[model samples]
Target: MSEAGPRLGGRRHSDERSSPQRSLGQRKPARTITIDGEHAGRRLDKFLRSQFKGVPAGLLFRLLRQGKLRVNGRKAQQNHRLQEGDVIDVPELHVDTAAAPRPAVPSTLLDQLRGAVLHEDDDLLIIDKPAGAAVHRGTDVSAGVIEALQHLRPELPELELSHRLDRGTSGVLALAKTPSMLRYLHGLLRDRKHEIERHYLAVVAGRWPADMDIVDAPLRREEDGVVVAGDGQSAETRVSVKRRIGNRATVVDVRLVTGRKHQIRVHLSHAGHPIAGDDRYGGRAFNRRVTGLGGPGIYLHAAKLVIPKPDGADLVVTAPMPRRWKALLNSDL
Candidate 1:
């Protein structure tokens, strides 16, 4: 069908449109919606899916294909972006037996997230993200940290992720309570990365040399299954030995200079001290042990974060290393 992308804003021209046919008995009346500030940046299809929560997805596309739905009184595609002050003339939607409720976030998941809150003020919500949890859900995933958090905190309409941690790497994760704060954090990372410090504690397979502290190699993804290489993007990590597990391993504090994909894991591995229990990156043993799991298992933990504030004083947050690793050295942490 129609490919008139919904330009329901940034100046507009009106056109006439009709409602799709109603099913069964009484017909439903149509209504006009003026897009508000909160809904400005959302997609038309997503907005429709949200507005009429129970209606089956197929109906929206079917109506779009048949020219029944309109933006500013003319047909518009589902993927079109919505703008503040734009008017949407919505026709009668036959929300009947096919309409279904949004999937309920599991109680267990909600409870886990409720307890995960490490810091919360007006602008931010930080958590000790569990190792095995996915930040966002995929096709096969039923629930993720973001999904559960949304259900847990419905008051935050502009809630969003400030940054992401790999599903397997547990610890200090931040979620912005509003869009403005999220954008500020993003700008801070992009423009003034040095002002913020992110540190991770990882257990490596053997003694990490104290002299070799910084890894300033470039990393690129290759096609041989997958890998981190030296010829791609500039990546850096500053590491220091935190402790030693006799002669078998070393606990190190890894400060990220530049955030890169698999930077810590790959950098340490390349430096001749692969994280213990690492499989793909060539540790002596590939033990799938999840110490703080949301994914598989790894000894890495996001130990601390230093966030810069406009008030001059920086905010520093820390998460303790997982205790199970203490047994590797046979002592309390």
Candidate 2:
């Protein structure tokens, strides 16, 4: 569970939009951030929103137009995709002084999270996130894995999601314990450098061939949350057949080359093998058939993560297959 190659390791919005950027002289001091590989290729506006969670979009646009926010000491456009190593100067804005308190996470959820921990250390916590559970609470979700864990371990106030897995998918999600560790890991993942490897196990609705192991495709996200293959963002996935059921399904191991939203699902479907139980994609028939036969939820699981540590060691983390997978795969296969 532990190895060493190298070990290392917001908010609020105000809606007042009256020339917020013009009052820079009276505003708080600015801060500079160095862009890394993880944030490379993202729009300038989007990156700022991530940094300043509660800032209004209008205010951000004003800042960009007024030349208050600069990249590499030069004025940048709102749609400017950032490059790694670029330095950005950010101007401060008024944030709501009184923020809403987080709601209490159910004790039952906390117990589930406690049992889901696969590995934990001073800098990182790896969890076997359950299927159908969101990693962080959103508008529709009241409490999620992140909220529950924070409540359960009140001492670790800095615990945060270093990456994310889809709600329908389950398995090895990592949480960083410190800011430096978070940045270190994010840089590795974003750049795809330092030998960071991620592997997934999936059950798809067809018999995939071992020879067809490479899926190099670009993905574009639609307004309705659907991903299509075309000229959007470049993405690739390496897929190999692990096991196959008689003329019905195949178990696949997927290595993501580019972490686009719904990348795996879109790529597999494009290859004519939609994941089982994925209704949003093309697995409705397969989902119905499996549900009628008492199958599990979506058949995608983040099984393993191998990350390079600062000390030139490898941090290998693994999660056991979900009970639903074991129960169904064993019986069905």
Prediction-by-prediction clash tally: 7, 14
lDDT of 1 at 75: 84
Clashing pairs in 1: 131-292, 131-293, 131-294, 132-293, 132-294, 132-295, 133-294
Top lDDT prediction, candidate number: 2
lDDT of 1: 0.72
* Candidate 2 lDDT over residue span 1-333, tens digit each: 112121212211111112234444435445667765545676788667755645667788898899988888998899998887788877677554344356668777787788888888877889999888898898988889988987887666557899999998999999987655787888988886564688999988878977999888878888876566566798889999888766788889999877889989888998999998887786667888766664757889999999888889999999887777765575463
Range of the 10 consecutive residues with the lowest summed lDDT in candidate 2: 8-17
Worst 10 residues of 1 by lDDT: 7-16
Error of 1 at 76 (Å): 8.5
